[model samples]
Target: MKMKNIRYLSGTGVAILVISVFSVACKVISPDTGELALKDAYKNKFYIGTALNERQIMGHDAAAIQVVKENFNAVVAENCMKSGMLQPVEGEFRFELADRFVEFGEQNNMHINGHTLIWHSQAPRWFFKDDQGNDVSREVLVQRMKDHIYTVVGRYKGRIHTWDVVNEAILDDGSWRKSKFYEIIGEDFVKLAFQFAHEADPGAKLMYNDFSMALPGKRKGVVAMVKKLQQQGVQIDGIGMQGHIGLQYPAIDEFEKSILAYSDLGVKVMITELDLSVLPSPWENTGADVSANFEYQQKMNPYAAGLPDSVDNVFQERYLDFFKLFLKHQEKIDRVTLWGVNDGQSWKNNWPIKGRTDYTLLFDRENRAKPVVKSIIQAAQQPHSDEKKKRKQSI
Candidate 1:
């Protein structure tokens, strides 16, 4: 790609713009600390995956998936099989797309994590209602939850390594969010959700994921919630941290505290939605974004500062710093997932930034891993296979 002239905040003294891909003129954003070379450290220890479109998955030859599978042990379908996305209308399940996705992982012997079983958003509205133009009865809701989990999880069985069994079920305060499950099933919906998932696929790991649990208030709430569930014999296997940091929030120390707290619960933890946005603020008001959902946000601005080569260096550096902490506690850290394939697809480019573009993913549009990607891969390393496949390709 040719360098394009770049400009931002035009002339604001505090304004900072680094050398974006398109910019020809160099702007001193932050001093470069040279390449972090993270891929080496992370090699063999983990897998990085993206939810690709049908084309990106099926269009690739074995080499594509092999390329990715060799680097990590797991791959996840972005949205092919989510409840709402798959079974938008009752009894009309669309399994073709997801079917192909799993095929790739199975062929490569990669650990596949079903993106989710339940989420308030992206679900077909029908689940919350019924045939008589009334809300579904509690029994109906429970059955639906059971049926969905049983079918999906049962179908995959030993093939799927983990199911985000109950996603974002807890509100930021750590109380259960009143999703379709809550509205129809009343309460204790979280327990039932996990219970059903366990029964469906006893072999697969089960997890509850949410953002904001990395703060003191919510983190404490999550800890309390997990303890209660464990006491009842609920099979909660993991907690997804949904690492969506932004321009000045959460104070790194606070985020670390959240990790330690969860680790103490003896439940495995992961930075599920790991994306850092250099987007603007008032992000507090953004809607339906992958990073800043209507449901969660980091309290303090997480993304603090301009993009100097040094700060840009720190931006990438900070990512590894957290990873190092993650490695320090690897016994409890299970996985780290980047929300999208590359910067282009990140919801951040448009969300809180509104119309302005944001560069925040580990890979650029060309499919080459970026500095951040290398750092993550290098922070830790383990053993992997010889499989080689491109994780993302044109469908």
Candidate 2:
């Protein structure tokens, strides 16, 4: 069905006003130019989201900011909301960038998400230390955890709709990471983080976010962990399967299995920090570890100038496959957030190995939607097999 017609106003000023007002509540798709907005295309199924870096949030890149506002309905902080950035010292809190981030989301009427409340990496050194610079006792750590969670989550309150309460606590092999939080507080750290976040904001959705979720070991570990939390009545709301994928790894079926397993826990499933790297990975098992870095190799940077047509074809197909899976199980998934707004800003370019060009996101360097954007929108708009069957029967 088409959008209803609107009569034109006389003056240019009045006509521009009408267009601006209609733009928010209704997207006027011109007959000549059938532009498909990503957020509008998938409005019924799930939220289309993107992460905002400091530059983008601060409006340093006006072109990228326009792309974000036009396409995505949800926003997550790329790094500003992390523990270290939010609180570098014991009692000090920095909300400069974070405040702007929340404001941007609010102005756009976006579903705002807090990147993390508790994370092993990108955490302040003071978070786990005593005055002597040794790890604090479990009791002290517990108190600190509560203070941090309450302060951060409390600040956002109802403004941020979702919080990654805990992130990457489980390793690829199903073992719990022995980060300072885990060493001092044991498994209850996850539980306590969830509890404190809930206390701060009862309305916000609390999520466990992780990468390499396609691994069987990690999948089992997450399912077991979430189940234990549920049994204890922790208010965990969702699981975020980080879509930091490459071309060869994470066979489609394995990814689907993880999605189904997480969905079975009766919680919303979110695809978070999602980016598909077109460049080769440095290691066979580099599972999105921020600390993992390797020396640059000439061979590693194949597409330094630009992605080849042959490789671009595969890249487009890979994105389509993931979107198809998302559309197939749209009922179980709540949100799908790209890790960055455009290829130029994507972290993949400088990760694992430095100075390698990567085409990872849906938008190109110029902030124009890539070919796959239309493919994804079209895939979402197409009727499902069941829907097609019903239509045939009706006819």
CA lDDT scores, all candidates in order: 0.67, 0.91
lDDT of 1 by residue, 1-395 (tens): 22333332455422344345323353211122133233224433444444455555675544334335434456777778789877888878888888888888888676688978877778788887877778888888888877887888887888888888777766666666766677777657788888988988888888888876666767877888889899999999888888777646557788888888888888888778777766445736412234453323443234333245755675677666777766665556778777766666676655653444556776655555667655555445432221112223322
Best by TM-score: 2
Estimate, for each residue in 227-267, the C-alpha lDDT of model 2 and write its tens digit.
Answer: 99999999998999999998877899999999999999999
User: Model 2 off-target regions past 4 Å?
Assistant: 1-33, 386-395
The root-mean-square deviation over C-alpha atoms between each candidate and the true structure, in angstroms, is: 13.7, 3.9
Q: Please report, as a residue range, the 10-residue window in candidate 1 with the lowest summed lDDT.
A: 382-391
What is the Cα-based lDDT of residue 74 in candidate 1? 62
Candidate 1 RMSD computed on C-alpha atoms after optimal superposition onto the true structure: 13.7
Indicate the TM-score of model 2.
Answer: 0.93
